[model samples]
Target: MQTEKYRGYTLWGHAILQQEGIPQPAKFAGSGTVTRDTKVVEVSGVLDAFDSDEEAELVGLSWCRAWVDSHG
Candidate 1:
C-alpha cells in the first residue's frame, strides 16, 4: 500500500494479488479520507488492473481528486 497527501486529503493505493483460477498479478484498489475539523469523510474504489504499482497509485490519486472535488 502507498499513501499520498493531496489538497488536505489522504489517498492510499492498495495492490492485491489473486491466485485463484485465473491469476491476477496486479489489482488496484484505492481509498481516500479527509478530516474537516471534527468530521471525517472517506471514499474507496477498485480500478482496472495494472502491471505496475505506480500506475495504480496514479489512478488512486485521480480518484481522490475527483472525490474531493465532488464531495468537498
Candidate 2:
C-alpha cells in the first residue's frame, strides 16, 4: 500500500490484483481517511486499469486527491 499524508487527510492506494470473483483485470484502488478532528469519513473505490504496480499506485494517489477534494 502507498500512503500520502496531506493537510487534513491521509490517502492510501493499493494495487488490486486479479482475483477469483472479480471479472475485471487488475487495477488501482484508493481510499481516503480524514485525519482532522471531524467525523470519521472513509472513501474507497477503483481508480483505473493497472499498467504496472508503480503506475497503479500513482493512479490511486490521484484518485485519493480527487476524493479528498470533494468529500473531505
Question: All models: lDDT?
Answer: 0.60, 0.62
> Which ten contiguous residues of candidate 2 have the minimum total lDDT?
27-36
Model 2 error, position 25 (Å): 10
The best candidate by lDDT is 2
Q: Which candidate is the best by TM-score?
A: 2
**Candidate 2 similarity to native, TM-score:** 0.61
What TM-score goes with each of the models? 0.59, 0.61
lDDT of 1 by residue, 28-62 (tens): 44444444443656656566666676676677667
Q: Against the true structure, what is every candidate's RMSD?
A: 3.2, 4.2
For model 1, which pairs clash?
Answer: none
Q: Candidate 2 at 60: error in angstroms?
A: 1.1
Clashes of 1: 0
